[model samples]
Target: MSNCSFCQVIDETLRPGGIAIWLMKEAKEDIKYQVPFLLAVYLDENVYNGALNFNPWRWMEPENEEKRNRRTSPFYAPFGGGARFCPGAELARFYIALFFYYFETTYR
Candidate 1:
């Protein structure tokens, strides 16, 4: 019953934010870091029909109650909190800002 936009995005046929490469890289890294957690969101039975007919677009559905709640609720903790926080978080932010700065200067 879903529109299957996530499939399109995954297949490289659709670019939601014009940043598919960035998204793909982040997704791949996330999967590597926490496969089970990512699967919990991406492979949940209620969000996806089956392993074969999987569709990540269904993530928008209310049926994914846990994910929806976590996304909307402020009670949830940030990814990697306290001393276990990501070491690359600051570097990633800096690189992203530099990318935007250069992109804007070069393109505009």
Candidate 2:
């Protein structure tokens, strides 16, 4: 789920301090920055417990379901966000569900 994000700084900005300053100490205006995704989905300790362990039952847990319904988990952006959100996200989900339903019934 790692992705590179590229954008130009619209205005000059200064960091308060303590963070590792990259390239310019201060973000200069109109500078196009190429930043790689620092967080890998599977490696993210904030989300999953262990990558090797498959725990589908975790989704059924009350607290986990609550977080999903609220959309508070930052690690779960599959269709992207904001104005660039995928227009067909809902359609894609519907198609997946339809396929699973047909496959289950036919196989059974």
Candidate 3:
């Protein structure tokens, strides 16, 4: 969740009225994922879209307006700052560096 800007905004926007709408939207999205899982059908579109976009490979360009909007948005902190920052960030960075180190060493 550290890399999720949406989660950070969600944290800040945890007010009474705002929280209701946020939870409802999140619940709807979760239900979309859950209903298919309850059925035996192996529909993969949503799962694939979510995972592939998160992957380093299969990179897709963002729309120009979307990029500009993100740049201007105050709630778009990819990583939270100050004392409330992500705890596992350093560990994640270390693991990523180690993975690359091992990959380069072994593959070369």
* Candidate 3 to truth, TM: 0.28
lDDT of 2 at 88: 75
Q: Which ten residues in a row have the lowest lDDT in candidate 3?
A: 15-24
For candidate 2, the 10 contiguous residues with the lowest summed lDDT are 6-15
Model 3 C-alpha lDDT per residue in residues 26-102, reported as the tens digit of each score: 46343444321211111133422332123322122242123112223222222332453456645644565567568
Cα lDDT over the full model 3: 0.31
Residue pairs with backbone atoms closer than 3 Å in model 3 (clashes): none
lDDT for 6 in candidate 3 is: 37
The residue-by-residue lDDT of candidate 1 on 1-108, one tens digit each, is: 123443222322111111111211246343445332332433345444563353445345565434323223221112232454456644544565567568768994
What RMSD does each model have against the real structure?
Answer: 12.0, 14.3, 12.9
Model 3 stretches with alpha carbons more than 4 Å out: 1-78
**Rank by TM-score, descending?**
2, 1, 3
